[model samples]
Target chain A: MSRREAPLNRVVMALSLVATATWLALPLASVAPNRIVPGTAHTATDLLGWPLALLACLPLVALMALSRRLDRVRCHLALALVLLLLMALPGWLAIASQWLVDPELPQARLGIGAAWWLSLFWLSLMLIELRSRLALVGWRAALLPVVVATAWWLQGAWLGSLALGQELDGRRGDFLEAVVDHLLLVGGAVGASLVLGALIALAMRQSPRVERLGFAVLNFLQTIPSLALFGLLLAPLAWLAARFDWLSAIGVSGIGWAPAFLALLGYSLLPMVRNTHVALSEVDPGVLEAARGMGMGRGQVFRQVRLPLALPVVIEGVRITTVQAIGLTAVAALIGAGGLGSFIFQGLGQAAMDLVLLGALPILAMALVADALLGALARRLDHRRLASPGGAP
Target chain B: MSGRQVNAWAAPLLWLSLLLLLALGGDWLEPLLRWSEPDARRVLYPQADLLTLLVRHVQVVAIASGLAVVIGVGAAILVTRPGGRDFLPLVAQFASMGQTFPPVAVLALAVPVLGFGTWPIIVALLLYGLLPIVRNTLAGLEGVDPAVQEAARGMGMGGAQRLWQVELPLAAPVILAGIRTSVTVNIATAALGATVGASNLGAPIIAGIVNNNTAYILQGALMIGLLALVVDSVFARLLPARQ
Candidate 1:
C-alpha cells in the first residue's frame, strides 16, 4: 500500500469512529422525557463491553480501507477478517457497558446484547464490502438473517429504554398508550386475513362453480385501499351495532380496533387466497397422482401430498401477506388499532421525530422478526421436501 | 386428455358457483327471501361524481405506477450490470422493505416533509410499488434464453441494441405481468389517500366510517372490487399465450 493510501485508510476509520461516537453522544446529550431512547434505561453503549466493540471496529475498518488500496483480488479476502472483527465489537461494547453502568438500570440481557452486536457488525461488513465477491457456502445463507435480527434486536434494546416499561399517562409510550391494544388490532386483522384467505383458496380449489367468484372477490379485495376497507368495515360494524344493542357496545364506535382489524384482513385476503390456490396448483402432478394411486382418499391426498408439496410456496405467500400486514396494521392505528403506528401518526400530529422512531422502530422490528422467522420455517420445509422419502423427486 | 380438459373447464365453473353462493347466500334461489336489511346508496356529492372519483384514482395510480416502472426498470438494469450483481440482492432487499412497511406510515412520515394530500400518497405508492416490478423485471430478463442472446451478439448487435430488440421483447410478457401486479396493488393502496385527505374512492368510505353509514362503505367497496376484477381479467386476456 502507498504511504498516501495509509493516511486515507486512517481517515476512513476516523470518520466511522466519529460517526459512531456522535451517534452515541448526541442521544445522550438530548435526554428528554419521551426521547427515542428513554433516558433511564441502560443501552448497549452504557455497558463496559461497548468500548471494546468500538475498539474492535478499528482493525476491521483499517483492513477494509487498506485492502482497498491493493489491486490484487486477494485483498477481498480481508472482508472475512473484517466481518469477524465487526461481530466482536458489539458484544464487547455491550458487556463493557453492562459492567460500567448501574446494574439496576434495565440493561440488555446478555443473549440479546450478543445477537444485537453480531448483527450490526455483520451488516456493516456486508454494506462496506458490497462491491466485492466474497462467497462462503453456509455463511452467505446465514448472513442476511443474522444482520436483520441483530439490527432489529438493537432497535428493540434502544427503544425498550425510551418507551417500553415506562408509565405515561393520557398518551402511552409515544403512540397509543396500550401496546396490547395495537397488538390485538393488528394481530386479529392479520390472523383473520390468514383464515379468510385459506378458506377462499380452499373453496376456489374445491369447486369450479365458485372459482371465478373467489377470484373476483380476491381481485376486488386487492383493489380497494386498506383505508377504504377500514371505512367499509366501519359501516357494517356500525349497522350491526345499531340493529342490536349488545352488538353496538362491541362493534361500531367506528373509531376503534374492530374496523381496522377487519379492514386489514380484507386487504390481506388477496395475496393469501390467490397464492394458496396457485401454490396448490403448482404441486407436482406426478406426486399427487402417486398419492391417489396408493389408495389415499381425496382428503388424505390433499392433506399429505398436495399440501406438503405446496407448503413452501404457500408459506412464501403468507410471508408476503405478513409483511404487507405489518405495514397495513400501522394504518389501522389511524382507526385506533394501537401498535407502533400510533406513535408514527402521533409524531406526525405533534411533529416529533423521536416519537416517530419510537413507534416506527418497533413495527419495523416486528416485520424483520416475522420475515426472518417465516423465512427460517420456509427453509426447513424446503429441506424436508427435498429430502422426501422418494429422494429429490 | 379430453376428460382432464373437461374437468379443467368444469372445475373453474364449480368454484365460481360455490363462491357466488357464499357471497349471495342463496339469494339467487330464494329471491323472495330477505336475509338482511337493504343497503343505502353511497353519498354522491355534486362535485364528485362516480366517474370523477374513478378518474382521479386512475390518474394518481397511473402516474405513481409509471414512475415506479422507470425506477424499477432502471434499478433492475443497474443491478444486472457485471459489477452490480454482487450487491443487487441487498438493493432489492431494501426496496422490499419499502413495500413491507405500511404506506400510511410513509404518508404520515411524508406529511411533515412533503405536506398533506395526494403527493405524499403518490410518493408512498411509488415506493411501495417498486419491489414486484423490479424483481420481476430482473427475473424476466435473466430468464431469457442465453443462446438467443449469444446469437444476437454474434450477429453484431451491441449490448444496448440486443437488450432493446431481443431481450426486452422476450421479457415483455413477464414485465407486463409485473406491471399489472404493481398497478393492482397501487390501485388498492391508493385508497389510503383518504386518511391524509386525498380525493378518491376512499372519500366515501372514510366519510361513512365517521358517520356510521354502511351504504357508503358498501358502495365504495363493491365498486373498487369490481373495478379490480375487470382490470385484472382484461389484462389476463391481453397477455400472449405461452409458446
Candidate 2:
C-alpha cells in the first residue's frame, strides 16, 4: 500500500500485442480429410484476414497507448470487439473448410491449429486485463459480454457448420441430456458432500479420535482414482441390488449414476471436511469467550458465533469441492453415467479432436463459473467479516 | 494418527510390502477375477500385464508430480519475495485457471499437439497438479513465524541464507503436505492417460469399459486403488514423527 513500487502493466500489455501480432501472421486453421489426417496450414492473410485481424487489435492498440494508466472504457470495448473478431475467425475457417477444398481433396475437415488456440489464450488474458482496467466490479460485469457472445455463437451463425457444431447437431438430444445429467450429478454430489463433510467435521471437533480417523479415511478415499472408485463399487452394488429386491427397485444398479454419484461424493469429501475443520478450529477463542460473557448458551454461541464466523471458509470448501467434482464427474462417464466424459471418450475413440473440445469446453466453462461465483462470495464474506459488529474495518 | 506416536518404520514397511505386491502379486491375484464371455468361458484380463502397467503408472505420476513440485514451489518462493509480491494473485490465478479444465480435456487437447502416449499425459498431469503445491507452498512459507525470521535476520544472515537455513526448514513440513497432495491427485488423474493411449493402470479400466468386462475393471481398479493407498500412506508419514 506504500506505493506502486513498480509499473509493468506496459510489459504485459506489450506482450499481449506481440503475441497477437505473431498469431495474425501464422496459420490459424488446417484443412484436412478427417480428424487424424494432417491438414495443410492456412494463414490469416488468405481471406479477409489482415483487415479483420487489424480491427480485432484496435482495442489492444488503445490498451498499449494508455498502458501507464489502467483506465479506458474504449479499451474494454475494443477487447470485446477483439474477442468477437477472434470468434468469427474460427467460423470463417469453418466456412473456408467447406469452400476452399481442392478438387482431389474431398471431405475436407477444418480444425483449429496451434496458433488459433494460443491466440484464444492470449485474448482471454487480455480480456481479463481490460476488465481489471475498467474496474468492472464483479463476475456479472465480466460475464456480460461473454454471455452475449456465447448466446450469439449458439445461433449457429458461423460455427454451425464447423465439425464440432455438426457433431452437436447430430446428437443434439443426447448432448442436451448429457448437459443436464452433468449439472445434476455435480449439484447432488456437492450438496451431499457439504452436509456430510460438515457433519464429519463437527464430529472431529467433538473428539480427537474422530478427527484422526476422519482425515485418514477421507484422504485415503480421495487418493483413490476416480475410475477405480467407480469400479470398486461395481460388484458390491450389483450384489446388493441382486440380493435385495428393494435395492434394485430403487435403481441401485452396478453402473451408471449410482457408482458415479457415490464416487464423486467420496472425491469431494476431503476438501469439504478439511476446510470445515480448519475454519471451525481457526475461529478466535476470544470471540467465543465474548459470546459466553454476553450470556449466550453453548448451542446459541455456536449457531450465531461459530457458524457465522466459519461460513466463508465453509463456502470456500464448497467452491473447491464443486469445481473438483465437475472435473471428476467427467471421468464418471466410463461407468455409463453418461456426462461430458462420454463425449470425450467417444471423441478420443473417433480421433475427432473437435468433438473432444465440444465436451471439454462446457466442462471448463462450468468449473470456471463455479470457481468465480463462489470465489467472489468468499471475498465478500471476508470483507463482511472485517466489518463485523465489534471489529475494526 | 494425530495423538498416537507413529513408528518410523511403519510407512516404509507398508511400502515394502506394497512394492513386493506390485512386483509379484499380479499372477496370484489374477485368479480372483473371473470374466465370463459370450461362450460361457471364464478368463483373466485379455491384455493386461499388471506389473508393467503399474510401473508405467508410477513413472508418469513421478515425473508429473516432480515437475509440479519444482514449478509450484519455485513460483511460490518467487512471489513471496519483495520484488515478486505483486504477482501473488496473478500466479495463483494462473495456476487455478490451469485446473478448471479437466485433465481428460487437457489430454484430449494435448494429444494432437504433443502426440500420443506419455508426453501428453505428463503435460496434463503437470497442469492438474500445479495449484495445490503452489497454494500450500505459499501457505507454508507465509506461516513461518515473523519474529523468528526477524531473529534470524538480526544474526546478520543474507536473504538466501535466511530463506534456505531458516524459512525453508520451518516451512518444510507444510510444503511437503502440498507435494503429498499434488502427487496423490496426479496419481488419480493420470489414469486419464489410458484413454489417450498412454499405457498405465487405467488401461484395464478403459479396456473393461470397451469390452463390458467387470473382471478387467477390477484388475485395473484394484491395482490403482492399492497403488494409491500405498503412495498416500508414504505421504502420510512424510511429516517428521514425534515420539
Candidate 3:
C-alpha cells in the first residue's frame, strides 16, 4: 500500500508525541540533600542542557516518524526503538543519580520525577501497542518486559542514590518478608477458595436450592467492602480468641492473618465458584455422551474428559480470584496482617514517599505477573483442547 | 408504576433511608454501641459526626465516579469511532492492565505526586475507577451488532444520531453495569483515604484502629457498609436485569 493509503499507527504516534512533550516539560528528577528534606525538581533541560535534552528526544521522534506508515520493517524498527527507550530509562536514572546526588553526602537521595515516570509509562504503552500490532505472542510477546526488567536489575548498583533504591536498601529484609507474606496470603486465600469454590460449585450442580442459596450468600459477601469486612470480623474473632485459649495460641485473633485470610477467602469465593460452575456446566454434553458410548464409566469420563475441558475456564477463574486477592491482601495490612501493605501503610503514616514506592511497586509487579502467568496457562490449555482430536472445536 | 416496579425500588429506598437514619441518628445507637466498648467514655466516634462523614464519603465517591464515567466512556467512544479505531486495541489493553494495579497501591502512589488530602484520594479513585467503565463501554459499543449499525445507516441516520439514539441506548445496560461496578469499588476504596488524611467514613475506622476501639471501627464499618448497600441496590434496580 502507498503511504497515503496506509493508515498511520495513530496510537504509537500519539503516545510518542505526548511522551516527548512530557519528557521535556516535566521534571526529570528531584534531588534532596538528605532523607528528611524535600527535593528540588530538575527538568531534562535543567539537568542535560537544552541541546542534550533535545538530542535525547531522538528515539521518541523516530517512533512518531516511523509510525507514519508501519510496514513490517518500519514496525520492527519502531519496536526496537521502544525497547531501546525502556532499557535506557534505568541508565538515565543512574546518570541522574550521578549528577544530582553529592558523593560527599551519603544521606542525599535522587528521586524519580514526573517526566521520567510518564515517559516510562507511555513508552510501555507504546511497546504494548507495537507488540499487538506485530502479532507477537507467547514468549515472543514476553520478551520486551523481561529484557527491560533485566536491564533495570543489572543497573541496580548504580541506582544506590535513587530514593526508591535507598529506601529498599534500608528495608531489604523487611521488603523480602513483606513480599513473602503477601504471596503466602494471596496463595492461601486463592487456594482455599479454589477448593471450597469447587465444592460449592459441585453441590450447586447437584441441587437447585443449594445453587440459589449459595450464590445469594456469596454475592452478599462480595458486596461488603474489604475494610468493613475486616473491621466486622475483628470483634467476633477477638471474642472467639478470648473465649478459646487454643485459638489465640494458634494465631486466630481479631487482627492479623486470621481475619485477613477470612476476608480474602470470602471475597475470592464468588469469582471462583462462578467460574467453576460455568466451566463445568458449559462442557459439551455430546462429548460426555461419546465418552459413555465408548463404555467409559462416570468417574472415568469425569477424570479423563469433562475435567480436562473444564480446566482452562477454572484456571481463568483462579486467575481473576488470584489477582483480586493480591490487591485485597494489601488492605489486610491494616489489621496487622504483615505484608507489603504494611510498608504502604507505614510509609503513608511517616510521609515517606520512597518507602511507599517500596511497597506499592512490588504489589503492582506481583499482580501483573500473576495475571500474565495465569492467562498464559489458560490459553495454553485452551489451545491444547482445540488441537486434540475430537476436542471441542 | 406497577406494584412490581415499586417493589423493585423498595430495597434501595429502604437502604437509603436506613443509611440516612443511621448517619443522622447514630447517637441513638450509642447505648447499643456502648455494649462493644464498656469502659470508654465515648462509644460514638468523637471527632466528626457520622452524618458528616457519610456525606463526605458520598461526595468523594460521586465526584470520582462521575469523572470516571465521563472520561472513560468518552475515551471508549472515541477509540471505537472509525477515525480513532487505531487506538481501540491499546485502549482496551490499557484498561484491563490498569485494573491489575491495586487501589491501595494506586492511592499510595498518588500521595507522592498529588500530596496528601482529598484530591489525591479523588484522583486515585478516579484513575482506578476508570478501568471498568472504559472496558465495559468498549465491550458494549463494539458488541452492538454491525448489522444494527447498517440498519441504522439504511434508515439514513447520521453517525452522531446513530450513536446517541441507537448505539448508546442499546449499549446502556452493559455500560450501566460497568458504572455500577466502578461506583461500588470506589465506595470501598474511598474509605482507604482516611489513612492518607482525607476524612470520610473511614476516619472512624482508622481512629478505631489507632485507639484499638472496636466501637469506632464498628460504627465506621456500619456506615460504609450501609452506604455501599444503598448505592449498590440503586444500581441493581437501575440495571435492566441481572446477568
Candidate 4:
C-alpha cells in the first residue's frame, strides 16, 4: 500500500456514525404480552446486555475507521461489513423474540422499534454509497439484498412471535389473494394501455392535428387525481351495469375492478402514448433513408427498422406505467377492489400497525422488484440495439 | 406583468373560479346529483361542507410541498457544492429509487410509524414529493453550461454568487417544473389521506363508499378533480413562457 494517506469518505463516515448513535440511543425492540396491548420498548443495552450491545457497535466503528483511508480493498471490506450488519439485524430480532416472548402465551408478539429500523436504513444507505464508490452495477449491487433476505429466511422460524409474522400467519390466504389481485390489476391495465397507446400513437403519426388533440386529452386525463377518477367512473359504470344484463353478468359494476381498471388505464395512457410517440418519431432519419435506399418499402421499413429501434423506449414506458398502476391499484381497494391495500385500510381502521406493515411491505417489495426487472429489460434491449450490425451506434 | 402573461393566466383563473364556485355552491348542484342516487336520503356529504374540506385539502398539500421544495432543493444544492460533492451519487440514486415506492404504500408505511392523522399524510407527501424536486434540481444544476460557469468565475464571481446569479437562474425553469409535478401528485395523494382520518376532500369519497352513496362520491370527485385541474393549469401557464 502507498504511504500517502487517502482522503476521508465522509458519506460512509457520517452514515456509520448515525447508525451507531441510533443503535445505542433508541429502542431496538418492543415486547407485548398480547396483540391488543402496546409493547414495552427495549433499548439495545437492556435487550442485549452492555457487553454484547457494545460488541455490536464494533462493525460500525470499524466502518468509520476504514473511511479515513479508503482503498479498493478497504471499500470491499466496508461493503462486506455493511452487509454483515444488515443480515445480522434479523438475527438480532430473533434473539429479542426468544428472550422476551413467553412461549406459553401464543398471543404474545414482538414489535420492531425505531432503532432497529433506523440502523437498517442507515446501513442500506451506506451500502449504496459504497456500491457506487466501487462502481458496482446490476447483479453485483443486488448481492446485499439477496444475502440479507437469505439470512432473514434462515431466521424466519425463530421470528414466529414477531408481530408482522403473526399478522401474516393469521391471514395467509388473504395475503396470497391480495397479491394475485394486485398483480392482475396492474398487468391488465398495463397490457391494455400498451395496445391502446400504440394505436393512438400510430393515429397521431398520420396527422399533426391528431397528435396535438390526442396529447391534450391524455394530459387532461393524467392531471385528474386517481381517487377522483375512480370516483367519477363509479356512477357511470353502475348505471351502465343496471341497464345491461351482460355487463352485470360480466362483473362490470360501479365499484370493484371495473372502475379500478378504468382509472388505472386512464393514468397509464399518458406515459404510454408519450413514450410510444417519441420513440417511434425520434428514430434517426438517416437510418430510415438507408432502409428506403436498400429497396425497402414503407411498410417493411417501419416493421423491420423503426419498430425494433423503438422497443426499448416503449418498454421504459411499460416500466413507468406498471409501477404507477401498482400504487393506484392500492387506492382502488378503497372502492371495494380487493388487493393488498385492503389490508392497509383495514389495519388502519383497526389501528393494527403490524397488519399495515403486512400490507405495505409486500407492496413496497413489488414496486421495487418491478422497477428493477423492467429497468434491466430496457437496458438489455437498448444494448442489443446498439450491438446489432445494422443498428445505430 | 405583461398583457400576454395576463392572457396566459386566463385558463388557470377560469378553472380556479369554477373550482371555487363548485366548492361554495355545491348545494345548488343537489338536484343534478340527486339523479345519480335517487334512493339515498342525503345526496350531499353532510359531515363537513365542501368549501372547508377544499381549504383543508389545499392546506395539507401546500404545507407538504412547501417543505419538500426547501429540503429537496437545499439538499440538491448541497451535494453539488465542493464540500458536499462526495454525497451526490448517493443522493441522486436514492432520489430516483425512492420514486418507485408507491405513494399509497408510503402513506401506509407512515401510519405505522407516525400514527394516524393529518400530520402523517403531510410527512408522507413531503417524503414522496421530495424525490422529483431533488432529481430535477440535480439535473437542472448539473445541466448548467460549464463554460458559462467558467466565465462567471473568470469574471471574479465567488462560488456562492455564481450559484445564486448564474446556476439557479438558469435552473429555475426546471426546478419550477419539478415543483409542479410534486404539487400535482401531492394533491392527489392528500385526498387518500382521508382514509387515514385526515378529513380532507377525500373524506367525502370515503364516506360515500361506506354509505354506497353515488352523489357524495361524485361531489368529492368533482371538487378534487377540479382542484387538480386548476393547479395543473397554473403550472402549464407558468411553464411555457420560461421554456
Candidate 5:
C-alpha cells in the first residue's frame, strides 16, 4: 500500500459539521400556538438558556484537534464516536424542545425548520462516510441502533419536544391505518405482479417470438410513467366496472386501489419477467442433457434441475419488484388509493413538513429494509452457488 | 441503410414519426377521438398546447437525465478509482436512496423550499434516475476482464490510455444499459411535474383525474407512453450488436 489513500467524504463531513453547528446556534425550531398558528423561533440557548443542544456535540468534539495525527484505529474510533453522537442529536433536540416549553403554553406546537433537516442530512452524510471506514461487524453495527434508541428513550420522558411524534399522536389511529393501507397496496400489487409476471415468463419461454414480444411490451409498459399507466387503466377499468355489476361490487372502480394496483402491477412486470427469463434460460445446457440422459422427462427435468437453480433469481426479481412497489405505492395516494402517500399529499396540501415525513420516512425505511434483506439473500444464494463443487447447473 | 439496419430501425422510426405528428397535429387528432364520444371533454388542458407541453416535458427529462448521467457516471468512475474506493457503498446507498424515497415524496418535500417549478421536478427526476446509471456503470466497469486489462498494461499503456482505450469502450454497453433504464424511468417520472405546477404531459392526466374525464387522461397517457417507448427503443438500438 505505497499509495496514499484519500480520506473518504471528509469534505462532506466538514460541511455537515458546519451545518449542524449553524442549526444548533440558530433558532433550532419554531414554536406555534397550535398547528395553524406560526410561532416564535428560538435557538437552544434562547429557549433552554442551558445550551443542552451543544451537549450533543461533547462526544463529537471531546477529542483534541491534534487527534487527526493519531493511529488509524484511534482516529477511526473517534470518527465512529462522532457518528454515534450525531445520531443522538435529534433525540437531544427533542428533549431540549420539551425542556424549553413553558407550562402556560400547553398547546405550543413545535415545527421542525430547515436548519434541523439540513443538520440531519449532513450528520447522515458524515455517518455514511465514517461508517465505511469503521469496518463495523458483529455487534458493531448494533451499536448505532442501540445508541439511537437510547437517545429516543431518554427524550420520550418529556413528550412535549417531539413535534413529529405529536403529529402522529394526534392521529395515532389514522397513522396506523395509513401504514396498514400502504402495506396492503404494496402487498396486493407485488402478489398479483409475481403470479402474473411468472406466467408471462413461462409463456415467453415457449418461443423466441413470445420472448421478444413479451420483453418489448413489458419494457414499453415500464417506460409509461406510473401516472400515465394509471390514467390508461382508468378508462378500461371504469368501463369494465360499469359493464359488470360484479366487478363494481368487487371494488374495481376507475380510481383508488384498483387503478393503483393495476398500474403497480404493470410497472412491476418487466423486472419480474426479465429476472425469471434470465434465470431460467441461464440454466446449463449440459445439465439439461444429463438430466434427459438420466431418463428425466421434460416436466421432470424442469421441476428437478431447472427450478432449484432459478429460484434464487426469481426471488431476486420479487425483491426488486417489492422494493420498487413499496415506493411506487406512495403515488397511489394521488388517485385516492389511500397509502402513506395520503399523508404526503395531505402534508403537501397543508404545507406540513411533518406529515410529509410521516409518509416518506416509512416508505424509505420499507425500501431500505427490502433492499438490504433481499440483497443479503441474493448474496447468500450466490455464495452457495460459488461454494458448491464444480460449477452452476 | 441495409435491410437488417432498416428492420432494426422500423418500430422506433414509426413510433418517432407518429409522436412528432401527434405533437404537431394534436388539435386535429382531438376531433378523431371525439368521433367515439363527441360530448366528452376532448381538449383537457385547453390552456396549453400539447406540443408546448411535450417540448417542456422533453426539456425537463433531457436536462435532468443528462445531468444524472454526468454525475452518476462521474461518481462511478471516481469511486472505482483506488483512492476513492472506500466511498463506493456510500455512493450506492445515496443513489438508491433517491429511488427508494418515491418521487412524489421528493416532490412534496422539494416544493416548499424550491417552490413550484421545473427545477423541483428535475430534482426529483434526477435523483430517481441516478441508481440505474451508477449501479450499471459500476458493474460494467468492474466486469472488464482483468486479463484484457493486463494485456493492455503489458502493451505499455498508461492508466489513462488503458482506461480510455480499453476499459470504457468495453464497459460502454453495460453503462449504456444503465443509462437506458435511467432515462426511460425518468421519462415516466418527469410526468410527476404536473402535480408541482410544471407544464408537461401530466397536465392532462391531472386535469382528467380532477374532472373525472378519461379522454384527457388517455390523451396524456398515449403521448407519454409513446415517448417512453420511442426513447427505450432508441436506447435498445444504440446497444452494441451482439454476436
Candidate 6:
C-alpha cells in the first residue's frame, strides 16, 4: 500500500472495527442497556469506540494538511470506505447489543431489526456510492445498481411486499427466511427455465418447423400475464393430482411454492428462448460454413461452433430471464409460495410499512448479489475466445 | 419449396390447423392431452371474444408500450447529444429506478392520484417497459454504420432529414424489435392491471385462485400464454431478416 493507501486502509479498519462492535451491541442494547457497563454500552459502541469515528474524519483532516491529497481515486476511496462504514454502523450497534445483553429475553432480539436496518442502510449507501461514482467516472458502474434496484423493487412491490408500505419490524427473521425461500424458488425456477428455454431454442434451431413452433410457444408464453400463468398452472397441476396419487399428495396446499415456481418458469421462457434462438442463429455464417466444410455434421457444428459463439448472447438472455424471474417470483407469493412476498401480502392486509420493509430488504439484496455474481460471470464469458490461447480452427 | 408459395400457404395453413385443432378436437384433447380447463368466469364476462380482448389489450399495451418507447428512446437519444453523454448513465439509472420500483408500487403510487383503471395500468406498463425499449433503441441507433451516416450527410441531407430518412429506416428493424419486446412485456405486465381495476385477463386468473378452481385458473393462464405466443410469433414474422 502507498502512503494514501495506508490512511485509506486505516480508516477502513476503524470502520470495520466500529461496525463489528455496533452489531454486537444492538441486541444487548435492546435488552439491558444498563447491565452491560455504562461506557461499553453506547459510548464504547459509538462507532468503533470513538477513535474510529475520529479516524473517519482523518482523511478529510489530512486533505487540509496536504494539498496533494486531493487526488481523485484517493478521494473516492476515502469517500466510499467511509460511507461503507457508516452504512455498517447499524449492524455494528446490533452486534454490540447482542454481545452485551442477555440472549434469552425477547427484547434481546433487537439485533434482528438492527441487522435488517443495517443491511438496508448498507445497501442504500452502496447505491449512493454507485450513483456518485457513475456521475464522476462513467455509466457502466451504474449498471449494477440499476439492475439491482429494479430487481429489488420489482420483487418488493410484486412479491415481497405486495405493493404495501415498508417499515421497521421485528419480523426481519421471517422476512430473511422468506428471502431465502424466494432465492430457492427463483433460483430453481429460473435455472430450469433457462435450461428448458435453451433446449427449446436449440430444438427450434434444428429445423424450420421446430423454429416456428418454438416461436409460437415462446410468444404465447410472453403474452400471458404472470398472475394468469399461475392460475393456468394450477388446473393442470391439480389434474395431475387426479390422475396420479403422488401428485395429489404433493399438490399445492391452499396456496404454496409450486404455483409460484411454475408460473415464474413459464414467464421466463419467452426471453430465454427468443434470445437463445437469435444468438445461435447469429453465430457467424462463415463459422458454420467453415465447420461444415471441415466435415463437421450439424450437431458437431452447433456444439463446437454455434453454441460456444452464442454463449454470451444466450447468457444475456439468461440474465434477463433470471432478473425477470426474481420479480415474478414475488407474485408467486400470492399463491402461498411463502417467500418475502408473504409479508408483503400480510402488510397489505394490515396496512403496515415495517412488515413490507422486512420483506423487501432481503429481496433487494438477493437481486444485488445475483446481478453482481452473474454479471461478473457474463463479462468473463464475453472474452472467452481471447482467454483461450490458440486461435479458432 | 418455392419461397413465395411457402409464405402464402404456410401462414394461413398454420393458423387454420392450430385453430381447427384447438376448436374441433379440443374436447377430446381435453381428456387426452388435457392442456387446460374451461373457464366459467370467462362465460360470465360476455366480452371474451378474441378480437375484443385483442383490441382492448392492444389499446392498453400500446399506450403503455408507446409511452415507454417514446420516453425510453427519447432519453436514449437525448443523452447521446453534445453535453449529454454524462447524463446517459443517469438516464439508465432513472430507467432502472423505474423498473426496480415495481409496476405494482407504481400502480399503488399512481392510484392515489391517477385513480383506478386504464391510466394507472398504462403508467405502470410504460415504466415497466422503459428499460428494454430504451436500451435496445440506443443500441440499435448507435450501432448504425458511421459510413452510411457520413455519406448521407455528404449527400447534403441535413441532420433532421438524415435521421428521419436514413438513420431511422436503417435503425427501424432493431428499434421495431425493441418495440416488439416492449409490447410483449407490457402485454404480460398489463395483467397486473387487474389489481388496480384495469380490465384485462388478470381477472379470471385472480378469480381462479380465489375460488380454488383449477380449471378456471388454467383457462386464464393458457389463454394468456397462448396470446403471448401468438403475438410474439406475429412480431417475429413481421421483422425483416437481419442483414
Fnat across every predicted model, in order: 0.59, 0.59, 0.68, 0.70, 0.58, 0.41
Worst 10 residues of 4 chain B by lDDT: B43-52
* Per-prediction DockQ: 0.30, 0.49, 0.71, 0.70, 0.49, 0.22
Please report, in order, the local distance difference test score of every candidate based on alpha carbons: 0.63, 0.77, 0.88, 0.89, 0.76, 0.60
How well is each residue in B41-154 modelled by candidate 3, as lDDT tens digits? Answer: 788775347777888999999999999999999999999888999988888888888777788888889999888989888987887888889988988999999999999999
Rate residue A385 of model 2 by lDDT. Answer: 82
The residue-by-residue lDDT of candidate 4 on B93-198, one tens digit each, is 7887778888889888887677778888898788889898998899999999999999999999999999999999999999999999899878877888987888
**Residue-pair clashes per candidate, as listed?**
42, 0, 0, 0, 0, 40
Residue pairs with backbone overlap in model 4: none
Better DockQ candidate (3, 4):
3
State the TM-score of the second chain for every model. Answer: 0.79, 0.88, 0.94, 0.93, 0.92, 0.79
Best model number under DockQ: 3
Q: Which pairs of residues collide in model 3?
A: none
Q: How would you encode candidate 3's per-residue C-alpha lDDT over A101-133 as one tens digit per residue?
A: 889998999999999999999998999898988
Q: Estimate each model's TM-score.
A: 0.69, 0.84, 0.96, 0.95, 0.85, 0.63
Candidate 4 segments whose C-alpha is farther than 4 A from its true place: A1-6, B1-6, B46-48
RMSD of 5: 4.3
**What is the model-wide C-alpha lDDT for candidate 3?**
0.88
lDDT of 2 by residue, A1-393 (tens): 445433545534654677668667777777777556677887666644678767656655665655544435445555566566555545655556556555475455566666677776766666665555556766656575566467556646655345566667778999999999999999999999999998999999999999999999987787667777777777678778999999899888888888899999998999999999999999898888888888889888888888878989999999999988988888888788998888987887787777887888888888888988898899888878888753421
Off by over 4 Å in 1: A1-177, A193-196, A245-253, A292-300, A389-393, B1-42, B46-63, B111-119, B197-208, B211-243
Local lDDT at A317 for model 5:
94
How far residue A364's Cα lies from its native spot in candidate 3, in Å, is 0.9
What is residue B239's positional error in candidate 5, in angstroms? Answer: 4.2
Which tens-of-lDDT digit does each residue in B59-89 have in candidate 5?
9999999999999999999888877775688
lDDT of 4: 0.89
**Least well predicted 10-residue stretch by lDDT in candidate 5 chain A:** A62-71
Clashes, model 4: 0
Instruction: Return the clash pairs for model 2, or none.
Output: none
